[model samples]
Target: MISVEGVAIDTRHWIGGRRVASDRTFADISPIDESFLGDIAAGTAAEVDAAVAAAREAFPAWAALSAPERGAILRRVADGIDERREDLARVETRDNGSLLRSHRRGVMPRVAMNFRFFADYAEKLAHPDMEIRGHRERVTYDPAGVTAIITPWNAPLMLATWRIGPALAAGNTVVLKPPEWAPLTASLLADIAHEAGLPAGVFNVVQGIGAEAGAALSKHPGINRLSFTGSVPTAGVIAAAAAPTIVPLSFELGGKSPLLVFDDCDLDLAVDLAVEQFDNAGQVCLGAFRILVQESIAAEFQARVVEKARGLVQGDPRDEKTDVSALVSRAHLDRVSGFVDRALADGARAILGGAAPEKGLYYPPTILADAKPGSEILTEEVFGPVLTFQTFADEDEGVRMANDTRFGLAATLVTGSPEKAERVSARLNAGTVWVNCFFVRDLGAPFGGNGKSGIGREGGTYSFDFYCDVKNTVFSPNGWKESSHG
Candidate 1:
């Protein structure tokens, strides 16, 4: 166990505004140096049941509060997160092997911002009322009872807050299941929520592996809605489990997104965007895996991309200078490495990195040249610092190759021509399209995918709609007059 302020920190399930211990615990290790961070409670089916029951009990009261009242509590939660920004960021860095620089400047701030945005947005939420043919019609948005929020390990706290903030703002009670690999930050979030004056049972955290706790939460009958962000295979299981209950589910799954580089594009900016495949060690779901360069300048773009990728510094995540860090775990590192090996065996040439380091769970940033369109390396989501290069003859072919993947979470197109950007953006099969930039997110815009990437949207007004149930009511006045038609 880890200690804080001379006291051992207990890692347990947070239920009903209190910490609840379990029969067993699992150790959390940092991938950066293989240091044992702490232990998290091994929650089970029974624990999931208890948490859901508590949320069900708290639903009526929480949903009864005014929208502004809920918004105030949510705003306080955001402030609390901001106040402990350093501690939260450090914990996340240690837990997930994300670079400290990313945690500080990117992930942590977004975590707080998600809460604040939802807080302010909740007040502006409204259900319109109109008179149709002299009859009164009203629309109402109600909480979707208990919500099950399952988050991935890559960005645990930030992703959890993405669903939790909107769900709470929409007056829904949440039962959050943080990835067992990085449960510390989420456990702390439970405390933060309570400290922010959120009512008991409104938000709960249960920690365990996906098979036990996650399955239990998904299969629970009391859950009215499910929001999951993870791999496609796991999402399939969750959807199957939730099917028996006929609950509404929102999924944000894997992606094999593509980045298109036109001959007219700025080579420097295109190179930088291509290097984003190495960002977060390429664990990002929206990271571009396939680089489709126009045939006219494919060779030049490939050379620049390989050089830039090789220049990225890889070392300890805690070091401020390190541009790339270790993968989340040794197993994941091996998985990513295996993909690279398979690609080389299939005649794909490595332009840069192609092997893991001798010591830690670090796979060097890799770039594969001559990768075929249907090759496993190009189609599958390696979720590592691996980039595959492919060429397209024309605009039509470039767009076609970009949309070839089964997953379509996001796509990026680099072009100097405004006409080409507008034309290509409309044809891309993705939830979000970046014309010249990559991973530029706006909190107010919809953020989800099509097909296997995800089922529904989860940002701005879309999040509000997903977390709540809309009901329409119509009434006829005692002396209502019908509209006269010719």
Candidate 2:
């Protein structure tokens, strides 16, 4: 419905320093009502080349800036995004099907906070120790030249900004390839960065399928580092593509995380936390997908969760009181529906929701009971608002079941006893574990999984490290150091 600079922008690509339009552009339909949003231009190899070339050209100067200068610019960028928070939130809601209330209130603010966090940590990040063991020696940090940041669709702008913002603060020129499914806000983010006085080519966004544009960005020799946030299978492709170049890579992959509910925890409190953990239909990587209920209170816990889950009203995200919204697209809904069907055939009982609303792209919030560990519902990252439950015989068994999956992003533990909470928290293999709570994330904490769930850490100081390379600068006081070479 809206056009910018005469180009029809859907969730399309912005390569190099220009917006691209293609005849082969694809439609962007809002999942809320199955209405056609607009069309996005597919990016080509040439565009990728141009983006990388521009990044390459901009790298030296961007990298060479003093740490304070970079930090100041990053602060300005954060302020700019904060100024346009409401507009950014609307674009995100249109692009990702999240609630406007949550987008404007929760998502956009967190993104701005991330930028400010990076700005605050920028100077501290570059501080290197002076070594005087036997001679005057010191070390410094250096930018990794051009970085390729590939983001996902779930939390489009927020997730990508976590990578792009800090990467820029760390002084790396970036060629961003946002998910084709959710690309609009990334383009908007690029516009904001430009408007905030970021040099052209210092940051760029290209919209295209991961198979085409994403692969090209990863494989390009000019890019010294690649930061990716998506599923594991896709991460494999990116890893393979970047292999020849052997660039440093940061990957935050899939998660089939667990949440353990103990008998000591208030049943009502546990139920509320479990439902909220899946916030926007459980599509997030850190979603507590598997619920491992303690043996003593399994029945009571399941009953409370089912009651809460049953009350959810699934419809368009725009509705003021809609607790849940549609999946990203029909294709995604079909995939989720197929998973539910397979789970049922495998003998999993659907207690809450198992089908999509017939009228629109609305997929109901679902909860499955007694699903086996090997079943599709339990094993794979279903990525829908589906909760799979299993009863545990004891505390040890619950911890074992929680760590069974290959993914380990986060886990939520509900228990009243302090000692028990500590024991279980220690046993959880996930990067983040919440005791008596769920979805407790702070901007300063380091968050990422230990197992197949991820490769690198992100958040506050950790995010800055991913985008930079530490250089050892040894200062020899005696004129010049002797070389071992003949």
Candidate 3:
């Protein structure tokens, strides 16, 4: 067990605005290697109840805070996060095995910005057009009682805030479940929120695995809604787990996002952005994992991409000079390696990296070419720095290829023509289609995908519709179904 200030920080659980524990604990390791990171207490169903109960107890007060008032507190919280920027960045990098430089210069800054973004955005949230309908007066939005945020470890800090920011901004109390793989960052973030003047239980976190704590959170009687970001299988489990309660569940599930580069696109720009898409070891849910390049320039673009990927310096995550680092764990590495083997068997040729480096859980930034459609690698989400590319003949073919996946969370297109870009973007079948950029999120823009990519929109000013319950009112031009008997 690790000790922080001699408080036996090894065994810890976040409950009721503080870190508490029962009797269970597990060791955390730096994703760089098997070195000890720390030990966190594993919360069980009982502990999950504690967090849900806290969020429920705090809901009325949190829901009553004016948008601007909540915004102000969140702004303070964002400021506090910036104050401890380096510390938080270090913890994230150490715990998750992502590039330290990126974590500090990229992830941490984005996290802080997300907080600030939502704080400012919440104040601007206005109701939809409340117009009269046949036998009905109008419609409106209201905060759901308690919200649960189930975040993955790949980018825990950023996503936790992404899920919690808007919910809290609109006055819904939150209980978050940080990925068991990287619980400390969320624990620390919760601590910062507490210090930022958030009321006790307004924003609570509990530590445990998906089966125990997560199932309990999804099935909790008091939690009004569930916002989850992870793989598709887990989403299915959440759906089944929430079945008995029939509570609303929001999912941001697996994505095999594609980047289609037409012949007109500047090759350099496309390659650079594609690298960024798969950076930090390509563990992001929204990373542009597939590249569908026009055949006219596929050969040259492929070579350039392979050159750039090969240049990625793989080493200790703590080194400031490193471009990429290790995968999150040995099990994850094994899974990715297994996928690489499958891809190889199916005739996908690897141009850069395919195996986990002998040293750490590092998978070299790999580029695969000639990958057949519906190949396991192409069809499934490979959350690694590995990128798969296939060539197409025409604009219509490119768009069709981009939209050929069951997953459609996001897509990117690089073309010079205003007309062509719009036409392709329109038919790409993705929730977010970017013309010249990738992975950019406007906090107020609704962002949920079609198909198996999950349901309900998040971000923008519209997500409250998913997080809130509606009551239809009709009584001599104004009445209510939820109101007391007339």
Candidate 4:
């Protein structure tokens, strides 16, 4: 076990603002070197019962607080996260095998920002006030009771807070089911919440495999709302579990997104964007690994991308200069490698890496050209550092190729012309389209997918809409017309 900021990270469930043990525990093995990290408590339906009860009991008082009051607590939470950013970043890197530099610079900061942004947003939240046919109307958002949040392994703290921040800011008590692979930071979050003076039972974390803790949390009748971020198949399971209870669900699922490069684009920027897919070993759902380059410039772009991929440093995640690191686990590494192997057999040509390292969980930044059209490598979410090259002749062909996927979470466009960027962005079948950029995000934008990628948006007002029950009240313009009937 590792200690951060003089506190030994607890692996037990964080329920009612304290650590609670379970009957069984599972070992958390680090992907960096396969070392044993800690023993995580295996939570089950019984633990879920205790957690839901805690949240249910805490809901009334939490929701009763004024928006600013809750916002103040969240701001403190954000501050606490910032104060321990370095410690938390190290823990996250050790647990998940994501680069230390990334966690310190981007992931950890974004986790804090998720809370701060929502905190201020809650204070300024406003619904439309209107008058129609001599009737005055105003809307209010009432907090949905006990929220069940299930977060994925990739960028665990950031994603968890992305959902948790809004849930708590909207004044709903939360019980979060963090991915078993990287559950350490969540326990630390429970500590930070307590230190930040967040009331007991306000935020809870249950750490275990999805089948046990996750299924129980989603299937709980007491849960008023659920938000999950993970694979499409896991989402299907959660949807099934929640359906029986009729619980309101918000899902942010998988993506096999595309990055389109037009002939009239900045070549340097397009090449850099293509290289960015190698970030986090390409675990990003919106990484845009499928590059649809304009046929005229396709050869040049592929050559540049290959050179960049080859130069990437693959080693320990703790090293600051390491550009790539291990996949989350041996099994996941195999899964990613299997997809590449099959693609090569189906006529795809590897430009950089086509195989995994023999010793470690490391899979090099792999680029493939001429992937078969209907193959799994082109159609499925590999969720690794694997890029596929496809060429399009013109604008119409590029847009068509970009939209030719079951997933529509996000798309990237690289072009020099303003008119083309605007026109093409509108036509792309994605919830978010990036013009000359990638992974640039705003907390207030609507952030979810269109098709199998996800259901419902969860940023700014969209987040509150899902976490709260929007209610409209109508009355006569002048004090209900003095109760004319009476």
User: TM-score for all predictions?
Assistant: 0.96, 0.93, 0.93, 0.97
lDDT of 4 by residue, 50-160 (tens): 999999999999999999999889999999999999989989898889999999888999999999999899889998789899887999889999999999888899999
Q: Where in model 4 is the C-alpha error above 4 Å? A: 1-7, 478-486
Q: Check candidate 2 and list the clashing pairs.
A: 13-207
Count of residue pairs whose backbone atoms collide, per candidate: 0, 1, 7, 0
What tens digits encode model 2's per-residue C-alpha lDDT throughout 1-486? 255223334354555555656556666667766666677777767778888889988888888898788877777888888988877877767777887778877889888877778777777764545768656555565787888989989998888888887788889998888877767777777767767778878887777778888888889888888999998999898899999998988888888888888888888888898888557876778888788888888888888888888787766666668778768888888888899999988888988878766777677788888786677788788888888889888888889998888788888898889999889899999888888777777776888888888887887767766777866777666665477454
What is every candidate's alpha-carbon RMSD to the true fold? 3.2, 3.4, 3.5, 1.8
lDDT of each: 0.90, 0.80, 0.82, 0.92
lDDT, model 3: 0.82
| Candidate 1 local Cα displacement, residue 412, angstroms | 0.3
* Winner of 3 and 4 under lDDT: 4
- The best candidate in terms of TM-score: 4
Clashing pairs in 3: 353-366, 443-460, 444-460, 445-460, 474-479, 475-478, 475-479
Runs in model 1 lying further than 4 Å from the true structure = 4-8, 479-486
Greater TM-score among 1 and 4 belongs to: 4
lDDT of 1 by residue, 1-486 (tens): 465323344588999878898998888888878888777889999999999999999999999999999998988999999998888888888888998898889888999998889878888877678998888898877888999999999899989999999999999999999998788888778878999999999999999999999999999999999999999999999999999999999999999999999999999999999997788999999998889999999888888887777789999888899999989998899899999999999999998989778889888998989876698998889999998889999999999999998998999999999999999999999999999998888887999999899999988888988999988899887654567453
Comparison by lDDT, 1 against 4, better one: 4
